[model samples]
Target: MAKFAVIGHKGRMGQALATAIEEAGHEFCVGIDLGGDPAPVIGQCDVVVDFSSPDALVGNVKAARSKGVPILIGTTGLEEAHFSAIDEAARDIPILQTGNTSLGITLLSALVKQAAERLGDDWDIEVLEMHHRMKVDAPSGTAKLLGEAAAEGRGVALDDKMDSGRHGQTGARTPGDIGFATLRGGTVAGDHSVIFAGNEERLTLAHSAENRMIFARGAVRAGGWLIGKPPARYTMHDVLDL
Candidate 1:
């Protein structure tokens, strides 16, 4: 069995992943907290799974690469610079990163892409997501992922078409623009809905996460699959073959 290291061992997702690793019959090599250094024992593990914060991502990737280990990063709130760092690290180690790793969300992304492709521009796409009060990031990462899927299907970049953080005096909904809405509070694990609104009809696709286990299980599965893979950047789509 593969030996895995968790980078956010003290966090919610990290704790869940620890349990999942055991249930999946894998060995947990090390647990690294926010300020903890992973370089000390990262070399002993076959793969590293990080659900920590974005600020810690680059260092974690560097440590994993030092030992030629694959890494699966589930941390969100990442900027473009973080991705560039990931790409640089991937030159020497395999890396898989995603906003959401649940199997259901993976399938939902595909379905969202298909719907965006089949439907005309007359159908305005709006993405909505909600998470627990403890979640720090707005517009939850899953919502952005779904928005990216829709943007990909329409042959447009997400940054160019996204309409988020609407304020006072916002004009009419722009055609072809992808809107986003975010909600926080309560104990909701996660909830995402993509609405395709037309003049006379509406189509909505949604998925709700009941617990953190789904993501933790997916992360463990990805870690297991990443073992012995070539040096490159991968996604959940690659892991699930979507």
Candidate 2:
């Protein structure tokens, strides 16, 4: 029965989350969209759930900090500086954020790590992601996370090895470089596949989000769980108790 505050109520995922909160019989304490801050309305809520834009999210985190409310940020495409801010704030509050909040994504990431480790360095890794038309970022952040797991397992640096979109009949594939391919169209919620190509056979690990609720509901659950803990920064794995 925790009070809930939904930031980014104007967006599709945000609105749907608001409805989900209501339908779940957990009170919707406040909802703020593009108009204004949810501070006034969510004054006494247990936690804040943000599905807002990346630009507006920094301010939202600050507001939540000011209120001493735990925050769950679901916005994507944020730079590391934004995460630093979250880390700074988490000294006195619990702040959980993830590129994609679907529980399955967490499982997928773990499996990717195992695959990368077992496949070893000789295997050429490529990630393919497809999303809906309106998503702004090129390589979905989720893709990068998967790539990071792959790189970590292979004992390499992600920034040093990531290669995005080859063109013009590029020659032989570099053994160490991990490639990422992005596709955008229609109302496709989200799709990601990590393809490992090597001698003999190729293995692909994929996950698809058929509905935004996979993320929204996961965020809501995270918000509810986060408000209880002490100050710290956490990801979906922490929420899922992995």
TM-score of each: 0.98, 0.94
Could you give me the TM-score of model 1 versus the true structure? 0.98
* Candidate 1: regions farther than 4 A off: none
lDDT of 1 by residue, 69-135 (tens): 8999999999999999999999999999999989899999999999999999899999999999999
Best candidate according to lDDT:
1
Q: Candidate 1, after superposition: displacement of residue 185 in Å?
A: 1.0
Candidate 2 — what's its lDDT?
0.86
Cα lDDT tens digits, model 2, 33-59, are: 886976666668988888888888878
Candidate 1: the clashing residue pairs are none
lDDT of each: 0.93, 0.86
Instruction: Indicate the worst ten consecutive residues by lDDT in candidate 2.
Output: 34-43
How many residue pairs clash (N, CA or C atoms closer than 3 angstroms) in each of the candidate models, in the order given? 0, 0
